[model samples]
Target: MTEVLQDLAEYIEQKRSDCVISWGFTNGELNISVAPSNITSFVEFLRSDSRCKFSTLVDITGVDYPDRTKRFDVVYHLLSMYQNHRIRLKVSIRESEAIHSIVSVHPSANWFEREVFDMFGILFRDHPDLRRILTDYGFQGFPLRKDFPTTGYNEVRYDEVQKKVVYEPVSLTQEYRQFDFMSPWEGAEYIISDDEAEGSKLMDGSKGFKDTLTSEQKIRNFNINFGPQHPAAHGVLRLVLELDGEIVERCDPHIGLLHRGTEKLMESRTYLQNLPYFDRLDYVAPMNQEHAWCLAIEKLTKVNVPRRASLIRVLYSEIGRILNHLLNVTTQAMDVGALTPPLWGFEEREKLMVFYERACGARLHAAYFRPGGVHQDLPDDLLKDIANWAEEFPAVLQDIDELLTENRIFKQRNVDIGIVSEDDIQKFGFSGVMVRGSGLAWDLRRAQPYECYDEFDFKVPIGKNGDCYDRYLVRMEEMRQSLSIIKQAIQKLLDEPGDILARGKITPPKRAEMKGSMEALIHHFKLYTEGFHVPEGEIYACVEAPKGEFGVYLVSDGSNKPYRAKLRAPGYLHLQAMDHMASGHQLADVAAIIGTMDIVFGEIDR
Candidate 1:
């Protein structure tokens, strides 16, 4: 590990243009934090440096540390294409300040950076076009910051003259937003330096002619806004594309349309309470989100999940993967104007939702996994039903494949569209099918096995041509692989008939037991009130989520609540790939490319 860190340090040192602040090998992986000012330079170094040819930007996100001197931290996770290694780089800046953008270096950073700016108020310097990504325009204050009010910083009123809604500033003096801003670092007294204040004025110049272009002219020449609500934009994502007619000169993705300040909310809630929020992060695959968070908490607490529970987790996660991929394939086809397949896909997904309800009592927001184990054991009949579905899915899959996969029209629309090369994949740090489609055989389940994934026999599918067609094929193959794993897990579940809950107090007593037994009642009351404590440290647990490697980096301060919780959603990374994939393609093909990427806005915005 020291050797690896030293090598990484040397590589960073050699790439002098890239600002490398501090780096070390932690949790069996190399982690580095760089300044955002050198984001483009750092990305170039990662792409060119032989020892650190980190071809892919796996994740880009922003963390709000309102109390800290550096108010926001923009984090980038990179994967080495040659070494099969991963490293994290973080660049922190004041919440009100703009850091250098990485869009030019890695097109995928466009959306991710915008998301940071939108939610946390961490500006990206030199961003082609930066606007509100998630929240409605004219929305006041960054919602993700600890100091920001939750009820909201602005009040909307109808504009009679403008024929649209308008925002008026709400008083920060009254804490109406459910946020407690008692920290010394918070409040309106915090003013920018004179130079920065001047810079802000210049950037926001009212007389600037550069901002006067008509909407049609903007799309025709350089600047293009794809969607605040475009059919292909997967969940209200808006992209400001700087195009040179048929070729994209530069693209900046504006995200945050779904921002709810989830991380901030997580900080206020107990570890267990945060589980439900994870379900909303990647609404398409709640099981994977739940599993990732649980795994992170488990690592921090050193909780022992039962063998049966592990098997159950694996089974549910695989089912979630299959469900997510099905949605991706069906939706991609639908976005490209092929509507029949989505209906067929939704039918299959509806059946999976039924299984989800039976397993966890909720369809999409199934808060199934607990820190130590699952919320409840799978019923015998439910397991049997899942097994039956797994058995029958292949035939349905074949039927869908026959109808859509080989259809000439579908191929014509998707075959060469949205092509992302291996180098582009690495530069963007993408994963799951996006990276795999580019011929990089990288899957978290295979590379860094979690749960009982090491015991399972499965193939990590890769595609030769990283295009829409390859992505479609990869998703289909992955569904089949998910089924195989599900079958194997079902067999294991049948063989292992033991307690699903761990031999500890992590789980609350059942309602019936609590009503009957005094001891059980006490345990339940204590569990609910105090919550379980975890050891002081941090753990980053990643799972191969449907979109990519979804990771949860959780920090526990020996409290019932997590000190900090960070979600590394793959959709955010995949969304970044859009600028690269959509560039050079006609404006009409953008929708098809966006659909093929399979991004969920909930994940991206969060």
Candidate 2:
């Protein structure tokens, strides 16, 4: 591994010449810092070079440093499926300068670049149709910038006179007692000025919710809003479709309706407080999201978890995967016409939800995972329930197979529909079942094992075709594999019964210890009030989430809170392929395509 990274560093430096500013290996990954001018050519080399086949664009985001002259640092993460290697490229650019867009090279940078533009106000030159993706129309300043206020410049309220929601200058109804006879909402005079509001349009390139075609051209292609509120969209996704008769000519997805500023909120809170925020990302599989965050923080802090905790994490993660897959398959079947799958699927999901509630107090937003380990150990009876469920799940799965596996109506609607190719998977950065359904045996658990995954024996399912039916088959097979893993994990838990959390300053004292000992009480207070600080560095940790590769890119500045927290949600990337996948197919197939992709807008719009 070291030799390969050394070779890659030497090869890049030797080929790129002065473009390579610096390079090094950290956390078993290669990082290359380059000039902004050479980013396009460098990424192309990484994609095409035989020695470095970093074909997959995992994620692209920006970090804002208001103190530096080059205030914005654009970071691009790439993965090599052939070699099982990863690399990160960073380029520091001034706020005034524009970084070259890699859309011409990767094509998947279409929405990622727009997100960076929307969040950090960084411009990407030559980006086709660059617009605000995760923000409202005519939004003010960049929300992710360091100088931006947490409460924002304006707040929306329903005006009694206007009879509609209107944006007004932010005002505080009551001040917190912590302030020294001053309100947190003070000094808003500067932000509420007319100049800044007017200057906000400097970056507004989109035609604000208007007609794209002239009256004469409208006859050929007309536009319709599919939903920010449509039943078929699954969530709060709003797709603007330009159609000719029954065929969709163009589809533009307008998300961010559920924008909660999760990343910025993570930066404001301590490390422990950020755990619950991830659960709200993909609410269906909250544990999977929290697992990625825990891995990233543990990697940076170099915390070692106990064997028991590892087994518990593996167990719940698999259960969460099955839970998520059940919902996807049943909902996909329901969208296509069959309704029985949902009834059977939700019944099983309720059982899993009970397991979640047994482990953690909450079912949907279970903040069970922590940096060192889990929030607490599982109950004694929970294992018995899971073991019994694993035994009976096969019969339930068989019922689903009998209903939809060969049903004529289900096959007619799904077979040979919304077909995606291997190239499509590579270009659009598809993972999970989307890539596996296309014959790519790339499960991260096997490819790059984490926690106790390497010790467990399991199979990675693959499909021959990349159609909707193939994707469904892949997910169903994956759930069976998950059940196998869960059984193994349950046995391991019984074999190894010990401490769940690692012994360190990071973990809080036990409730019994805190009640009796004064030292333990102080330790608990300090741990919660000022969270454990991590070493100054950056790391990108990922897990094979049910939807796809859910990753957390964290940078710590030796501070309690994360310097910059960016979530690389697979749903966001998968949703980008909707227009391409649904272009030629009839408009009715859009729902089936969306169902197969399994996008939860909570993660996509985050």
Q: Kindly give the stretch of ten consecutive residues in candidate 2 with the minimal lDDT sum.
A: 173-182
Report the lDDT of model 1 for residue 148: 62
lDDT of 1 by residue, 335-371 (tens): 8778888888999999999999998789989988887
The positional error of residue 282 in candidate 1, measured at the CA in angstroms, is 2.6
- Over 150-186, each residue of candidate 2 has an lDDT whose tens digit, in order, gives 7655777799999999987665332211223333345
Error of 1 at 455 (Å): 1.0
- Which residue runs does candidate 2 get wrong by more than 4 Å? 153-219
What lDDT would candidate 1 get against the real structure? 0.77
Q: TM-score of model 1 relative to the true fold?
A: 0.80
